[model samples]
Target: MLIDWFTVGAQALNFLILVWLMKRFLYKPILHAIDEREKRIVAELANADAKKAEAQKESNEFQHKNEEFDQQRAALLSKATDEAKAERQRLLDEARKAAVALSFKRQETLRNDAHNLNQAIRRKTQQEVFAIARKALMDLAATSLEERMSEVFTRRLREMDDTIKEGLADALKTASDPVLVRSAFDLPAEQRTAIQNAINETFSAEIHVRFETAPDLISGIELTTNGQKVAWSIADYLTSMEKGVDEILKEKDKPIAKDEPKPEEPKPETKS
Candidate 1:
C-alpha cells in the first residue's frame, strides 16, 4: 500500500464540508421541527391536566351544593308539617270550646223551661184541688144543717153594732112595702119574730115581714130596698181568701218583687 496523503486529505476535507452542509440544512431543520413538536406536546398535556383538575373541583362543589339543597328542602318540609299540625290542633281546641259553650247554653235554657213548667203545673193542680174540696164540703152541709145554723145566726145579729140596728130601722121605715129579707137558710119563726120586734121598737111602725132562702149565700142575711143590697156573707170571706192566694202566687212569680214589703190587711171593725 503506497500512501496517497493528498488524495486522502482532499477526500477527508470534502466529507467534512458535506457534513457541515447537512448539519446546517437538513439536520438542523429536522432537529428544530422535533423541538417545536415536543414543546407543543408538552403544552397540550399541561392544558389537558388543568382541564381535568378543574372538572374534578367543579364536580365536588356540585355534590356539596346538592347536599345543602337537599337539607334545606327537608327542613322546609319539616317546618310545613309542624305548622300544619299546630293549625289542626288549634282548630280542634276552638271547636271543643264552642261545643262546650253551646252545651252550657242549652242546659241553662232547659233548666229554666223545666222550672217554669213545674210552677205552672203546681198552680193548676192547687186550684183544681181547692175547688174540688170546697164543692165536696158544701154538698155535705146542704140539709139538717140549716136548723142548727139558726141559733148561730141570732147570736151574730145581736152582736152587730147598734148603728146597724138603727140603719135597719131607718131603711125599713123608708120602704114602701114590706122589705124582703133573704137568707142562706129559711128563717125560723122565733128568729123572724125577734127581728121584726127589734125593728118595730126603733121605727114605731108595723113592717110586714117576708122571708126567703137562698143557698148560694152560704150563711148570710140580705135586706134589699130601693134596689140596693147591703149584705154580709161567708162568700165575701172566701173571696178575700182567694185574693190572698192570688197575691201569693204573683209574688212567687216575680223574685225581685218579693223583696218588697207587703201591705198589712185592714183590721176588722169593732162592733161596740
Candidate 2:
C-alpha cells in the first residue's frame, strides 16, 4: 500500500457519509415500521384475550340459567304429583262417606217398614177379636142373660163395702143433678122398684134416680153422679181376655234364641 494521506482521508469521509445516509433513510424507517407492527400485534393479542374471557362468562351465565330452569321444572312436576295424590284421597273419602250414609238410610227404611207392618197387624187382630166377642155377647142377650145380669147387679150393690157406700152417699148429697142409672136393656117394673128400694135402704136418703138404656153397656149397670161413676160390666172380663191374647201374640212374634234347645215331643206308649 502506498503511503497516501490525502486518498485515505478522502475514502474515510465517503464511508462516514454513506453510513449517515443509510441510518437516516433506510435503517431508521425500517426500525420504525418494525416497532409499529409489534405494537399492532400486541393490541390484537390483547383484544383476542378479552373476547375469550367474555365468551367464557357468557357460557357460565347460560349454564347457570339452564340449571335454574331444570330446578323450576322439577319443582313444578313434584307439585303436580302432590296435588294429584291429594285429589285422589279426597275422592276416596267422599265415596266412603257416601256409602256409609246410603247404608244407614237403607237400614232406617227397613226398620220403619217393619214397625208399620207390626202396628197394622196388631190393629187388625184387635178389631177382629173385639167383633167376635161382641157377636157372642149379643147372641147371649137373646137368652135369660139380662135377667141374670140384673140379679148380679143387685147382689153387687148389696155386697158393696162401707167405703163405697159412704162415697156414693156423699156424691148423692152433693150432686145438683139426678143420679144417672144406665143399663144395657130396659129394666122391668119390678126390677126398677127393687133398685129404687135398694138405693133408698142403702144410702138412707131420698136421692132422685134417672134410668137410661145404653146398648153400649154390654150386659151391665152404671150409676153416675157428678163426675163419679160406679160400673160393673162383662166388658171388663172381655178386656182381660184381650190383654192375655195380646201378651200371647207378642210372645209368639218374638224371635227364637239360637242357642236355646227345642222342646222334646211326647213318646207313644208301647203295648206290653
Candidate topping lDDT: 2
Candidate 2 clash pair list: none
In the range 89-155, model 1's lDDT, one tens digit per residue, is: 9999999999999999997886677557655654565556545655665677653433334444445
The whole-model lDDT of each prediction reads 0.72, 0.80
lDDT value for model 1: 0.72
TM-score of each candidate structure, all chains considered together: 0.35, 0.44
For candidate 2, give the lDDT of residue 192: 77
The 10 consecutive residues of candidate 1 with the worst lDDT sum are 143-152
TM-score of candidate 1 against the unseen true structure: 0.35
Model 2 residue 199 distance off true place after TM-score fit, in angstroms: 1.3
